[model samples]
Target: MSKRGWIIYNGNLYTKKFAEQIKWLRKTAETFDFEIDVIANNQLLVAMEEGCARILTEKQKPDFVFFWDKDLFLARQLEEQGVRLFNPAKAIEICDDKALTYLQLANHGIRMPKTIIAPKVFVSLEDDSHLGQVIEILSFPMVIKETFGSFGEQVYLIKNEQQLRQKAKELQHKPHLFQEYIASSYGRDVRLNVVGDRVVAAMLRKSDQDFRANVTAGGKMYRYQPTEEEEKLAVRCSQIVGADFAGVDLLFGENDEPILCEINSNAHFKNIYDCTGVDITKDMMAFIKETITE
Candidate 1:
């Protein structure tokens, strides 16, 4: 019998971009003779009874799940029921939160920008006095990022104390972090898509208009050839985050060295495909098949 699987995505995200990713995965599964079903994360109800958790769904459980959504609770519940997740719940949890990702990478010999995780505040702060220490560490022209964001949407570049205080106050009630801006890589960065232990594809994203180089932020993509060091770093970061596969973004340090930017557990490959013509879904499906069969 053919192996059965599922691709779980966020149901609330109704966009062609998301739909295309699911379509690609399903199409790739056909080549491997794997029976893959697409399901929304919210469609399955997680139930807890008698100190045990179970998924209440009419659909039959599969041999594995390609968890493309960041619903960690659902992912964990499925795992509790003995369903293997491609990127495990713990991995997704760590990658979903920028603070968690950075904390996990700390002391791991990963070269990243100097980052200071903001303290969690229950109530909004009335003044900018709390940002005194942050300003001392990472001065003007720094970058601020929300803990949970994608496509570089919740990232900000603070040019002065005014911008810093404004952005900090805006995100005070939310989880965020401050980091030194990589001037060498101000408008450019490299994205390496790693499957298993290898980088399957890479692209350099550049934006003349914005500090962030994410494609969704109006950046353009081009094929990139990563150095040995860059490739190793991407793979290592993925391993550290416990991700089976990931899109690792690398920033150029002052001396052209690679610095860790961020890792995406459920990275979108459409732009990389358009730029490099490399279909990541194929490698992803192959990896899944090999993992489940073995």
Candidate 2:
């Protein structure tokens, strides 16, 4: 019998870097007498319309599931059939919805910039009730995001009411947000990979030309120095999302206070490794082994 793991690299092939990583992982598994299988049979839209399993197998009901997408539709399907899924369905939901996660975090005193979730339809814009509340709670230059964003896409820093109105006109058909962008984090934020209640490694992502500091948006990474508090927050985020490990993005404010911006259930690690020389892949594998071995 062969030992095996599944790395769910969902979505269409778009990046050469990811393609290379998949190859590397396949080789690594083969070397260890294990197999790395790419399970594309459980795609979200395909599973919806087809209502069938095309190429999945009972034997391939993975022992270790590396989740790549945040949507739990497919993951929930896997669990009903007894295939263990990482990050669980509920965790996926909480992290997937930016508004709900911050509410929970705020209740726990975890620092976060002001955030708001506006519905797609405004039945009574004249009421000005909820709108007033949002304005009062969050300040200007607030960010509007599409809830599910990755690598810096779908993120908007709304500078003023005119901009917000214009943006709303553009994206009002869909649910969006109004969040306070920490000016201090202007082009700078920390991305920390937390594995199993520990901060494995962190990189400070800086965007000199853009406001979005995510590496995908032209942000460069450097050695990040996080205080114990930030580390604790990272751990807390992991727990909130029910992920034993996650990448926590923390933003610094005018006073240098750490603000929890986003929690990535499946964070990319290449840039961190390239800049900091920290290979979390091996450590993460070790942690997973230890977790199940016990």
Candidate 3:
């Protein structure tokens, strides 16, 4: 019998890019003789009775799940039922929250920008005195990021105290962080796609218009070769986050050293594929097959 599995994605996001990603994975699985069924996260219902939790779905359960969504609740419930998730719930949870990602990386002595997580606040900020300390440490022209964001949507580069105060007030109620901006890597970054213990593909993203080099933000991608140090750092960061596969973004330090940017648990591989001509889904399926067989 052929191995059976599922590719779970978010139902709410109706976009062509997401659909294409699923298509790539499903097509790759076919070559390995693995039967894959694609399902949306919202399609499955979770039920808990007497402290026992289970997933209620019309579709039959598979031997494994390629969890491509960040629905932590559903992911954990699936794990509880003894279903193996590709990146696992814990890995997704950590990568979903920027503060948690930084904490995990810091604990492991990973090199990254100096970051200070904002305190949890309700409603609005009653006092802005803490901003004084944040300025003293990070100074002017700092980077502010929401703990929960993707595609560089919630990231900002504040040039002065006025903008900082304004952005802080706007995001006071939400989880956010302040960080030292790496001027050396302004408008540029390298994204390495890591599968298991190695980097399968890499691309340099650059934007002349904005500080963020995300492709969604109109950045251009170029095929580039990573140094040995850059490759090692990307792989190590993926391992630290407990991700089976991830897109590891690295920033260039003052002397061209690689600094950790962020890790995407369910990284979209189409852009990397377009730039590098490497189909990451193949590597992902191969890794999954080896893991399941082992």
Best prediction by lDDT: 3
TM-score per model over all chains: 0.97, 0.86, 0.98
Over 4 Å off, model 3 = none
lDDT of 2: 0.73
The runs of at least 3 residues in candidate 1 whose Cα sits more than 4 Å from the true structure, single-residue gaps closed, are none
Q: On residues 1-294, what C-alpha lDDT tens digit does candidate 3 reach at each position?
A: 788999999999849988888888999988988999999988887888898788877777788999999999999999988999999999999998999999999977689999999988988998888999999999989999999999999999999999999999999899999999999998899999999999999999999998899999989999999999999999999999899999999999999999999999989988998999999999999999999888
Q: Kindly list the per-residue Cα lDDT of model 1 for residues 96-199, writing each as its tens digit.
A: 89999999999999999999988878899676675898899999889999998999999999989988888888887898999999999988999999999999
Residue 293 displacement in candidate 1 (angstroms):
1.3
| Cα lDDT, all candidates | 0.92, 0.73, 0.93
Q: What's the ranking of the predictions by TM-score, best on top?
A: 3, 1, 2
Q: How high is the lDDT of residue 45 in model 3?
A: 76
Ranking by lDDT: 3, 1, 2
For candidate 2, write residues 1-294 as lDDT tens digits. Answer: 655677666556537887766665566545555566765434433243366643244554567666656646677776666655556667767777777677667777778877778865654233324555666677677788887667889988877767766676676556667788788889999998988889999989898999999888999889987899889889987886687668899999788778899887767677878988987776666675565556
Q: Report the Cα RMSD per candidate.
A: 1.2, 3.3, 1.0
RMSD from true fold, candidate 1: 1.2
Clashes of each: 0, 1, 0
Which residue pairs collide in model 1, if any? none
